[model samples]
Target chain A: MVKKKFAETPNFTIRKDFRPLDVKEKGLVFVGYEISDDKKTMNQFLHYDQLYTIRHGWNSPFFIGLLEGKIMGTRCPKCGDTWVPPRTHCWNLDCNLQRTEWIEMPKKAKVHTWTVAGWSGRSSLKRLPIILVYGVIEGSKTAIANELHGVNPWDVEFNMPLKVVFKPKEQRIGAITDWHFEPADEWEPSPMNKEKERIKKLVEPVYEWVKTLK
Target chain B: MSRKVCIIGGATTPFDYGPTGFESIEGGAAECVREVMRDIPDFNLRDIDMMIYSHFSVHFGHQLSAEWIIHDHLGLVGVPHYRVENGGNTGGSALYAAALAVKSGQHDVVGVIGWETMDSVSQSQGSEFIALASDIRYELMVGGIYPIYYAAMANKWMRENKVTEEDVALIAVKNRNNAMDNPKAQWYRNEHRYITVDDVLNSRLISYPIKKYDCCLMTRGVAFLLVTTEEYAKKVNPDHYVTIDGMGLSSCTIRAGDRLNFPGWIERYGPGYPEMTEFAACRQSAEVAYKQAGIDNPLKQIDFGEIHDAFSTSEAQIYKALGLADSENIAQFIRDKETYLEGSIPMNPGGGLMGYGHPVGATGLMSAIEAYYQLAGLIPKKHLSSKTQVPDPHTGIVNSHAGTGTSISNFILRRV
Candidate 1:
């Protein structure tokens, strides 16, 4: 009981009339931590994603331009630079101006970087495959994330020419990417693998932490 | 131009999650400004000097590439303005930037407004998107989400200090009750009546130690603050005011993934380590504000105010960091209800981010505005009319955290 409580939320000490170290066997390699209610410890694990907790911005395109396969980052008038995912101010450290004009992101660009994801179970996606990437676009200060189709994750070469493809409007989820990435070639787009993303999201973290245990 | 600035006026709209957008945040900005104008009756919006517009979800609003969409809609077009984004800290950073603008003598009257609409995005994607704000190269790129970070922090706190998971729950119960008096709060009256420590310990795991009650609900809203100089304060009403006493902003590494001593919430207590995004942020930011206000003992000196209690774990760290209660002994403070709005140092009179809503972009200024009203005794009857009401809580401070280990600011407001 004494040890498990401590393991649950580690770092700060509470003042207690009964010190945990006083009565327990101190040196059994966390014999103290295992003192918590073993059956109940697992019960404390929570699912914050569900039961309506925190959520962020939508993914679908806000304007017609994005739905029509346009890169629509904002452009600041004071700096007169075009922001691909448009911005209200010049993010330039020195120039501080709001009120930007919307501009089209240059479609013709090379792949800056890429990651392949195998699907995990979630809404509409069941072990589906997907590719996520970021790169320099013409006239944009920041790189944006988009879905990559048609090419294998291993085949995703750097600086390769690619064009944006809007997802079917019915498939939109109000996210930044109502559209995803597609090879400039009109060949069949790959159905994203969700397994890789699942491993990245679920397994990698505990795996890394456990390595330090020994 | 000394290294100091003053708030001239401020504004906000009723907060909700996602149902509101940039237009609504803009609308809140408009309403808050209109309220400020009504209160001042002298300074006109057109007469204000410059502006900084902040929004964390402009992309979701589909207004990402066009800040002008809201900038122009807000009617402050031709003067001077820029959009600001620092993930979650954009709101406070906006005020911090506005303060810099004032001290630099760049803008005489600056309107700093932040807004967000989260429902605009689907939930699963929201987690990944927010996760992106961390050191994505290392943190998000690997798959750690926000609560995981907090869970890591909670893990650290429990390990170092002889504390229990129930301690984290106590914070949630206390904060939600605090939200009851807050008309603008989102989770003011939770359905789970009379939650207990055992209940918290048995709840579903969100990265562990972070139960459902321990986390905050999502909501939409906008907040605005107008700031100027002490001289300018005399021009705006002079009496019902709160000066920017000692404002300090800093950013730190929020990812525990990087530190061997990641559990060092107690160990990493140091100077010049600015705003902290972790639960520790409230404490660090409070330390700066307390020092600036010449407050040697925050619990005894500074009056009650609001903070970014985005998670119950965060409030635990804030209370401990602020010295309102020792980390281990925090559960007692909740029983005393000393941190509530009607308690010894009424906290979250506006219900905080947990109750009111966590709009990310507008949070900082809203915390400041709540402090402003508390100090000015300008609280509405709803917050004051409750069984929990102790009437006016004057002279307070507002502290909030932003982004992946980005910036935190502490503002002290006093009734003039």
Candidate 2:
């Protein structure tokens, strides 16, 4: 199998300055510089940077399946239990570390829970007011969290039917982000309620705030 | 046979210490030790047989093995020490470790010191760092920060239990209002001491249903508690000590999805058991603690509580898990003012995490200290304000939780 190239490594620089040691004693070195304006209340910054290569190990199949437009989960053969975001082994005490086998899950799912996230970590800020849901995919015993598109933040409801939409195979990488959920074609949002209006009002300011961030 | 343990005394740096609180982590820790020593008469650093330190994340301070520096700074260079880290339950876990040492006759006196320096990074970056606590491969990849996770739970919980946005906002208002009486509360440092449900509703939206006011502050502070054997407690400040009667620690799956349709959970807890909406770990921990403390009904037996209200929604769900209110009547429980200062079960009288500020590592110890003060009848003395003091309280519960109720440590303290 050919090694798939990921994104380019971003270039960055670290600021550093050297100064004579203030201590009278010898054999001492300073690695941090004061950043505070007040001399009495000294604050210093020490630069830290590193790159990590994490392994999926036994969970690699789950990510690989995402790239192939398949939702793969694990099943405890002994107990006939299935899981999405596949577990390497059954967590049940009765199963006692029983290794699970991979099983293909259906694209359809039900929204077990959801949130219209107005803010997010720095990387995903551009996707503000995004609807995230923990959906129990068909044939899987556990739910998997992912972004839900094709619905307004206020229109989301409990037990909403959804179907997974995978990225085009050419654009797919072996990651959970390879696919996202969209409202099933047959479903329609209910008429807005007082609660939905309240949420809509609450989320309006978030869009304005996110604009300022840009 | 095990010996009983007691919290003789403790002290904490103001929760709103902010970015420039101290020059270094060691300085902040030493100050806490000094303050604690000064608070307890006849107690000195030399009397501490062992020490346990709680610090949540090394990412914030950019330092590892910080307990070693803290121990050396406190002039405890030769003392045996251990460090405990359990996301947000760091402080409670450290206290539990120290109490076990005293109870099992391993040590006569154990000191629990905890601190967190979160001001080292910007608020956005801090959220990113905290989001890393979630399952990086799955949850974190989808931008699962705490507010989003809690908001999802809040959404489901509110829908299932008929809890409205106003009901959740009431908790924010109450806790922030309660903070006015706590000199060390972060709210005391802010310009706005009083807030209403409308104010909470108007705050900036963090995640849908979770506004800025609903969240706890990122704090930098230190706290230390001294745990001693029952006999040693009598020799020390016996008149002002609270016994550690019962403790319970429990954990659940780090991924919220695992809790859904968990095998045997429904059979054990009935329908909706182990639902992602409620904290099963919290309920389990409370049950263990109540069983040990001989508490049949927490609402009737416990006088007050110091809850880990990372978000207003969490506090309401915790009240149900702690059995302070029934699940069906939770919204009514809050509407009836059952958790107010003058109510039957006053909670977070010293301003919980939402008001007190959560320094992660020190938050649980702060709760424990608040419980200690309440049971020892020193709230007015310690807080310098009598407004939050429970009326002659005899029993109190201190709860410290992490993740979406992934790890929980609960303690039941009683006046001896």
What is the TM-score of each candidate's chain B when compared with the real chain B?
A: 0.85, 0.97
Q: What DockQ do the predictions score, one after another? A: 0.02, 0.51
Q: After superposition, how far is residue B185 of candidate 1 from its true place, in Å?
A: 2.0
Question: Each prediction's Cα lDDT score?
Answer: 0.59, 0.85
- What lDDT does candidate 1 reach at residue B76? 71
Each prediction's number of clashing residue pairs = 87, 0
Please provide, for model 2 over B1-416, each residue's C-alpha lDDT reduced to its tens digit, 9 standing for 90 to 100: 68988998887888774553654778877777777667776887898899999999999877788889888878887789989999998888898899899988989989998988887887877888998889988888675588898888888888788888789899999889888888778887764469899999888888878898998988888888989998888887879888988899998778888887776566568766778888888888889999988999899999999999999999999998888777679899999888999788998988898888899999999999999999888888888578888999999999999987889989999999
Residue pairs with backbone overlap in model 2: none
Please, what are the lDDT tens digits per residue for candidate 1 over residues B91-184? 7778878878887876777778777766556665666666767754323532335665555455445534444566666666666666666666
Q: Compute each candidate's TM-score over C-alphas.
A: 0.61, 0.93
Best prediction by DockQ: 2
CA lDDT, candidate 2, residue B318:
93
In terms of lDDT, the poorest run of 10 residues in model 1 chain B is B257-266
In lDDT terms, how accurate is model 1? 0.59
